[model samples]
Target chain A: MSTFRADLHIHSCLSPCGELSASPRAIARSARERGLHLIALTDHNSARNAPAFAAACRSEGLAAVFGIEITTREEVHALTLFPTVKTALEAGDEAYERLESEPFDPGFFGDQVWVDENEEIEGMLDKLCILCATDLSLDDLGPWCRSRGGILIPAHIDRPAFGVLGQLGFLPEGPFEAVECTEPLSEDLTDPWPVIASSDAHRPEDIGCRCLEFEAPEADFEALVMALESGKTRALYGNK
Target chain B: MTIKELQTDMNCRAVWNGWEDREVTGAYTSDLLSDVMARSEEGQVLITIQAHKNTVAVAVLKDLSGIITASNRPVPDDMIETARDEEIPVFVTDNNQYETGWRLHELGGF
Candidate 1:
C-alpha cells in the first residue's frame, strides 16, 4: 500500500462564497500541481459541479470524490462524500429541494454559477441561497448519507464557527464515518473517531493546503473509505 | 432590571429560566458570536438570532447575563439544556435584533 494524499473538502465556483476563478478544471489542475492524488468537489449544499470536477480530475489523472458541504438545520457544516457522481447528484437534489426559496441576491451572497467540465458556464441557481441551512439536521443526515452509500463527516470540528462542536456545543451520537479538523490532530480532541483534515478550500491556491495521508493500494474512493473506516488516516498540516 | 423583568418588558418567552435572577446592566445585539465574545461586557444581555447551543457557550464565556434569541428564531432543546446547565436564561422575542435592542435601550438596559 502507498500513502496517498487526499483533500476531501474543496468548494467549486458553484459555492457562492468561492472565488469565480475556482472552476472545476482550474481546481483539478491545481490539485495535480500540488501532488494531490485524491480530491473531492464539496461545494456548499450542492454537488452540481461534481460532474465537471470528476471529468477534470480524470483528465488530470487524479481520483475525485463527489461531495457536498451540507449546512444542516442547526447550522452545522457536515461533509458528505459519495462513491459515484450519480449518487452525489442525487444527494445534491435532496439538499437543493430542502433549501428555503429565498430570493438570492448575487451582489450580496455572491454568484452560484454552475460550470461544465470544459470550464464553460452552464447555468446559475438564482432562486435559492446555497449558503443557508437545509431542513436536514445532523441527526437526519447521518443515516441519510450512509443509506445512500455515502459517508458524513462533521467539517472543521476545531473551528468555533459553523462547526459541529461549535453549533451543537458537543458532537451528538451519530453514525459519523470520520471527523474533519482543519488543524493537526491533538490530544485536546478526545473523540474516538478517525480524524482527517482538509483545506476546505474556496480558491484554487488553497486546494491542498491541508490534506489526508492514508495507506491505500490506490487513490480511489473505496480505498479512501476503507482507510477512514479503519482509522488509518493521518492529517497533514502545514508542509508536513 | 432582572432578566425576568426584561423578558416581561420585552415580551419575550423564556426558553430556559436560570437558577437565579440576574440584572441586565446592558445589551449588545449581534448574530456573530465572535463579535459578542470580543465586545459584549459582563451583566449584558446578548440580543441575537443565533439560537444554537454555541451561543449559550459564548454567553458563558463572556459572562453575559442572558441570551435573547431575536426574530423568534427557533431555540433547540439542546441550547435550552445548555443554558439551564450554565444558569444562563434563554429567551425568545418576536422582534428582530434592532427592535429588541431598541426596546432594551428604552428599558435602560444599556
Candidate 2:
C-alpha cells in the first residue's frame, strides 16, 4: 500500500458560494498541479457536478470521491461522501427534498453554474444551493447517508459558524465515521472518531492547502473508506 | 433596565424565565455566535435570530444577561431546556433585530 494525498472537502462552481473559476476542469487541474492524487467534489447541498467532476478527474488521472457538503436543519455542515456519482446524486436529491424552495439570485448569493468537463457552462441550478435542509436534522443525516453506502463526517467542527459543535452547542451522539477540522485538532474536541483536515476549498487556488495522507492500495473510494476505518490516516496541514 | 422590565416594556413573550430578573447594562445583536462571544460584554442581552442551544451556550460563556430571539424565530424545546438548566432566561420578540435594538436604545438603560 502507498500513501496518497487527498483533499476531500472541495467545492465546485455548483456551490452558490463557490467562485465561478472553480469549474470541474479547473478544480481537477489545480489538484493535480498541487500534487494531490485523490480529491473530492463536495458542493453545497447538491452533487449535480459529480458526473462532470468524474470526467475531469479521469482526464487529469486523479482518483475522485463524489459527495456534498450538506447543511442540515440545525445549520450544521457535514461532508457526506458516496462510493459513486450515482449515489452522490441520490444523496443530493434527499437533501434537496428537505430544503425550502427559494429562488436562486445570482447578484446576491453568487452564481450556481453547472460546468462540464470541457469547461463549458451547461446551465444553472434553479434554487439556492446554500439553503439549509429545513427538514433534515443532524441526527437523521448519519442513518440516511449510511443506508445508501455513504459516510458522514462533521465538517470543520472547530469553526464557530455552520459547524455541528457550534450550532448544536455540542456534538450529539451519532454514527460519525470521522470529523474534519481546518485547524489543528484541539484537545477539547478529542473524540473516539479520527480527526481529519481539509482545505474546504471554494476556489481552485485553495485546493490542497490542507489535506490528509492515508495509506491505501489505490486512491479509490473503497480504499479510502478502509483506510479511515483501520486508522491509517494522518491529518496534514499547511499549504503544499 | 432589567430582563423582566425589557420583556414587559417590549411586549416580548417570556419563553423560559428560569433565572431571576437581572439588570441588562447593554445589548448585542448578531446571528454569528463567535462575533457575539467576542464582542459582547457581561450583563448584555443578546438579540439574535439564532434560536438554538449553542446560542444559550454562548450566553452562558459570556455571562450575558439573557437571550432575546428576534424576528419571531422559533426556539426549539431543547434550547429552552438548556437555558432553563443554565439559569438563563430566554425571551421572544415579534420585532426584528433592528427594531428590537432601537427600542432598547430608546429605553436609555441599555
Candidate 3:
C-alpha cells in the first residue's frame, strides 16, 4: 500500500473526444477533491494545454506530469510524459506537425480555445498554424519524448483499438519506459514487463477514479516518474 | 544480434543499407498508428503488415530505424520509394505478423 496517489492519464479539452469542461483548472480541482497527490494531462497528440494544466495543479499544491497522448502510425496509442511543460510543449510541436495535415490554417479549428489557470478563455492559439500540419512518425515521436527527458508508455495495451497488443500483436521496443492498462489485468501480468493502470479519463469527474500509487522520495513530478519507471507502484480503483 | 544480423537471420534483404549503421534497440510489432506514434522509440525496428503512405509517415514520425512488412507481403512501390527518400529500411518477410513478431522476440532477446 503506497502513500502517494497518482492519476497519470487524464485528458484535457484538446482531445476531440474530451469534455469541454475538461479544463486544466477543472482537472486540478477534481484531482484535489479526489485526493490525488499527482496527475498528468495527456491530451491527444497535443501538449498545448500542459503548461496551463501544470500551473493549475501547482496552485493547488498538486504535482503534475506534462504529457500528451500521441497516436502512432501503427494506430497504437501511447502516453508521452515530460518532466516539464516546456519539454512537453517542444515535443508537442514536433507531434503537431506530424499528426496534422500540411499547409495548416488556424482559422480551420475555430472551435479550439486556450485558457489560463483560472479557466478563463484567454484567446485562440496564434500558432493554430502549427497545429495544421505534421509529418512525424510514431517511432520518431517516442525518441523526441525521450530526448526531452520524458517517458513514453503504451496506452491501454489490453484494449482492442489503438492498443499495442491489439494492433502490433506485441510490444515494440522503442522509447517506452512503461505500459499502461486501462482496465485490470485479466491475466497474471508479471515479470519481463512493468505495467500500470489509469482511468484514461476524458472528464474531470473521471479523475482519480482509477489511479496508480507510487512510493517516491517526494510528491514531485520527476520523483513520481522515476518511481513509475522503476516499477515501484500499484494500481488502485475507486468504484470497484 | 544487431538489426543487420536479425535481417540476415530472417533472410531479409536490406532495402535501405544505411539501417545497418543504426543500432537495434528492440523490436516492436504493431499496425495501430496512434499507439505506434505514442510508443515507438528511435533506432528501434518496427514490424507490421499494414502498408500505406501513412505507414511511412508514421515511421518517419517515430524515428524508427527500419520497418518490416510481415506476412510475406510485398511493400507498395510508393512506400518503397518513400522509404528510400526517408532513409528508412523497408522489407517484406515470408512470416506472418504473429510468427515474425515471435521470431524476432526469440532471436533479438527483446
Best by lDDT: 2
Q: How well is candidate 2 docked (DockQ)?
A: 0.05
lDDT of 2 by residue, A114-222 (tens): 7776778887877666633446788988889999999999999887668888777787887798899888866567477888899899999999999999999999989
Candidate 1: which stretches are off by over 4 Å? A127-131, A185-190, B1-46, B49-110
The whole-model lDDT of each prediction reads: 0.83, 0.84, 0.72
TM-score of each: 0.72, 0.72, 0.62
Please provide, for model 2 over B1-110, each residue's C-alpha lDDT reduced to its tens digit, 9 standing for 90 to 100. Answer: 88888888989998865579888999999886646644678999999998888788778767899999999998999889889988888999999999999999998455
lDDT of 3: 0.72
* Residue A157 lDDT in candidate 1: 85
- Per-model TM-score (chain A alone): 0.96, 0.96, 0.85
lDDT of 1 by residue, B19-75 (tens): 588788888887655456556788999988878887886677567889988888889
Candidate 3, residues A1-240: lDDT per residue as tens digits?
A: 347988889877666556778899988998998888988888766788877897898898998888878776666778888888888888876776666432223222333455777777764433322112245555776677777888888889877656777776776656467778876775444234567778788789888878888888788777776786777888776533
| CA lDDT, candidate 1, residue A137 | 87
Q: Docking quality tier of candidate 2?
A: incorrect
Candidate 1, residue A153: Cα displacement in angstroms equals: 0.5
Model 3 residue A101 CA deviation in Å: 2.9
User: How do the residues A84-162 of candidate 1 rate in per-residue lDDT, one tens digit apiece?
Assistant: 9999999997898786545434664468888987789998876443435678989999889988999999999877668
| Residue A99 local lDDT, model 2 | 64
Off by over 4 Å in 2: B1-110
